[model samples]
Target: MSANKGFETKVPENEGMDSGYMSGLVSELASGPLSEPISEVGSDSGKRISVSVEEEQLDSGLDLQISEQLSNLSFKDVTPTTQPLLVDLEEHKPSIIPQLDRLFMQDDDGDTQLHIASVHGCQKSVSTLIKVCPQRAWMDVSNDYGHTALHLAVLSGHDVVTRMLVLAGASLDVRDVSGRTPLHLAVEARDERCIKSLVIPSPNTPREKMVRILNMRDYTGQTCVHYAARAGRFDIIHLLVNCGADILAGEGLAGWTALHMAARAGDAALARAILDKYGAAAAARDFAGRSPRRLAARTAAAPAFAAHRRDDTDTDSDSEDDYDSESDEQESLFEKLVQLNNPINVV
Candidate 1:
């Protein structure tokens, strides 16, 4: 040890500086002589590294778990960004003020929230909006296209929404720019559910009102049945007829009935169904004094009508033959009875 600050400690030089001794000295300097066993130190360092790796893995696992939870809890509405519509008045009590007035807020296209929700098939929003609607008439608010929410709902194939609107007293008679009522649009869309929804009997809608709606003519003077008939929807035509659509009633300048439209379109099945359902439609004349039977004669439905007539003729001939045979048998039996009664004089 040197007392001076600049002095360095000196050691005696060894004349026998063996390589093994030098290596031992180096090892001792690198690791303090008082340090723990090499194995223990190495294990401790390994444990530290392993702990760091384990910590990283744990953090990653936690992150993955959190991500999975978030994915599982994810929710979406009709639109991803848009929130649900107004609260249902009968279900949840709204904390804030009622948004009934907001429902009437119209866009540039004059479509209200009801109309938008209806077309988007947002059943929850539609149900809430209908519940909170200030008036039944507001449900009929139309867009620039003159389409009410009901019309848009039906046209967009949102049958449930259409039914909701119909039950809420939305007018089915409102005509659009195309002069088509909701019923007409339903038939045009060929949506059986929407059609049934519209025609389903409701206490708010009278039978006469439903009939009027069913037969209500569009700008083209075509009723819903006419549209169904023109489209060769025999089932829909039958439905409309059962719903009080006048099959024999004429339309437009031609005054053509649904049968006339079916005949013109060469829908033999539809023509037959119509004529069979309402026999008067066969003889029913259009404005041109042409009946559906006459129209069908020139179209592809002629053979169907011919076969139908032949079948009718055969049925009538069979009935006549049975009547004549019965009459002859009765007359012969009566003569035998008379002869038997006078058998004493004759024999």
Candidate 2:
């Protein structure tokens, strides 16, 4: 082992590696085996490798110190000469959520630690961050598109993370730049668990403003039910309906109701569910004054259903066969509701 003698390679006067940091690393290496070879790559560019300490043998204090070094150094500068020293990856992992503020890895779009964890489905990090991070962060932190932790979690389909964020005080109704709430994202993503997490409050907890939460419309004035219908997620539609979402609620973009969305897709189970559960919406008209039945008739499924009805006319002379009379037109329209396929379990 030598002193501050031959190893002192003065860094340039301008700017480069932290001088104190470089000296400290070199001084530590001076205590190790003398025969360790220096990196050949650095030889051309004044780069020098010195450390030869056994990484795993370092105790907790050294482990943390080494972890800091690992964070600050690239492999080119810190590679071991004789044998590779494998740093314990666990020690370097950002375990504490608040530590994100000090970390160099900033999430894309300036998303707070909570948003990144939520987007990645890091449940533990999300839960901890919510509890310990500044309240203002949870309340106000949003990414470039104005998505909060809750919105990202729901959109990313992370159910546990979504619930944890909500319970930890993230706003359930926080809207994104597009004015979409977590519930809207959940519906659009068709994530059942996330939908329930956002819509259904925890047991023993008082419900959120039920009317506001379930019926809260996005910028387009469409509610969760509208998204559910469009996605053909009958279960989600049923869930929102049970939550008191209006089946006839008008969408902002086209003023189309949930029924209109269902009918446009020719999702018979959804249309039937709306009809069976809330009969008025079945006959409701959109901004274009087109009834769901009319919208439904325009769909590919509608022609398929009509074709099915026509082909089956040989066996059963249903009301469709009686459509020669105008009175049977209404009855004929009613039979257009069954489907190309029954994916939804409607009662």
Candidate 3:
């Protein structure tokens, strides 16, 4: 075997040597056989290593070749020490396009960049951001309708988004600038799915005391049922009625009832349905003194005609005879006044 070699290391006296004689003796012994050989060394001192550009390029090429060869090698051929390093490098490779699509699509807005992520359909992103950076999401998130993500999802008929927001402990009754609720938006959009999703039972309350919390009125004092009436949507009307809408609830400029609205709209079937189910007591009287019946009469004359027909035959014929006798008496009095005007005719 080659003799063990150690390079002589020198320390300046100013560097502080605590054991001068022992260190020097040890250094002398280390330079002889029995010392470990040094493979490579480096120093902070300004020293240049002689290397040509061609030699540097060749070394770089050799390193690249070795890396490529290692990459091509199977896991079975890799050493245990290098397996974890290769795994880390492989794990850092960019995800596939479809995987990225799925990731972004899982969020509502389908945005990969963090800055552009807060958008209307991006319910997942909005929810995630609500936990991650609530202030930013609250301040910056807006949808296509110039509404915040909450408003957009609520108004655009996305119940899932609404529920996600609510579950994340967002405010339930927050109104948009228009002073409309998510319920109002659901009604306006005629989305029963969203409406059903919002009908939550009260927590730890008596069943009788658990009043229907949703389908409340907007700033216009118009409930969801009122919107259904105005739209002539009987299915929505039925839904609202079943869900506890008061048929007698008055709203709008004229404070019209659902029955009155149905009448005014000339929706005879809907009017009849409301009247038969809720009773005529629910009919409203507008400022014009027109009740549901009166308004209905304007559009449908059958009821009015029937009413007149019932009264027409009840008049007494003797009343007409008495009126004729009275007219005869008035004619004689008129003739007397005429005679007084002409004295010769009177004689």
Candidate 4:
């Protein structure tokens, strides 16, 4: 019989209200006067109820529901399994690129910074030295065997680092104290990339300079091409020839040519290629007076040496032609010398 008797509804314990009633209560609360006393009531059935309190509780419950829905909406589909949402997080990680050290850290045998860089693949450090301390990068930088930075890079097969050093104005023609250039290092390492990169002409260097570098003799007088042949790098021999490296060039106390080295290394293909393209002049005598064919004949490549017999015959013809020209020049020179020495005979 009370004013709210018919509206008496059991509010279940630990149970939430229906959505319609919750919405109506929220609307009533928004429109009603402020400062109204909030209270709770209980039905005879022991179901707890409150006029204003139910509305507030329902609003709080609705707020919680809305908050949950909003949270679900904001969640990404690709949420990570670990950790809560955070804007930023600090993480420990190793660097992808290598860090470089000082160029000249003193070690047992005075190993240079360039030496370390080459052995460890420290391109960054090598590059830094080239840019910041070029003089230090160049000064007395050698490995235990007296190889230079170019030598080390060549030995290590670090083509990019080698190119960087060359472009940074590293002396392409500078030999180790042993007189071996980077090209010689490439041959020793049998690295075609280093050889190719080193042989290619740079903007600042002329073709003649490149050729001179290729022909540069080490302390042993072995040219870069000779080393390539010795290392059994046939491709390099071809590359050198195409670049105009003298086919007949030799060095060392033994004066070995590229062909001689190839023959000694038992590289029949390289020897044949050299003879075929550049002619038998390439296989001519070294300081030991042994032609590449003779060296090959002594090796397991005797068949290759025999194959070049016809070429050697042609080479003999060329030699005869050269001797004739030289003999004519000698006669002309002798006549001039006699005329200069005995002017009274003309009178």
Over the stretch 18-38, how does candidate 3's per-residue lDDT look in tens digits?
Answer: 222123322222232112221
Q: Where does the lowest 10-residue lDDT sum fall in candidate 3?
A: 83-92
By how many angstroms RMSD does model 1 differ from the true structure? 35.3
C-alpha RMSD between model 2 and the true structure: 20.1
Error of 1 at 37 (Å): 81
Whole-model lDDT values for every prediction: 0.59, 0.51, 0.41, 0.51
Error of 3 at 184 (Å): 1.3
Task: Highest lDDT: give the candidate number.
Answer: 1
Which pairs of residues have clashing backbones in candidate 3? Answer: 108-121, 108-122, 109-122
lDDT per residue (tens digit) for residues 1-347 in model 2: 01112442222323233222123322232233211332222222454433332322222121111123212322122222232222111211223222333321235455554555566665444433432232333444667777776776676666666655654446766677666788888788777767766555432123447556788876656678877877877777777776667767887645678777776677776666666666666456655455566556645445423332222212223333433444334323333423212313333
Which candidate would rank higher by TM-score, 3 or 4? 4
Model 3: residues with Cα > 4 Å off, grouped in runs: 1-119, 133-148, 202-215, 280-282, 287-289, 300-347
Q: Could you give candidate 1's per-residue lDDT for residues 46-125 as a string of tens digits?
A: 33111111111111111111122211221121112222221122222232123334446677777777776666665545
lDDT of 3: 0.41
Off by over 4 Å in 1: 1-99, 310-347
The model with the greater lDDT, 2 or 3, is: 2
| Candidate 4 global CA lDDT score | 0.51
CA error at residue 31 for candidate 1, angstroms: 73
Which 10 successive residues of model 1 have the least lDDT summed? Answer: 49-58
Least lDDT summed over 10 consecutive residues: which range in candidate 4? 84-93
State each candidate's clash count: 0, 1, 3, 3
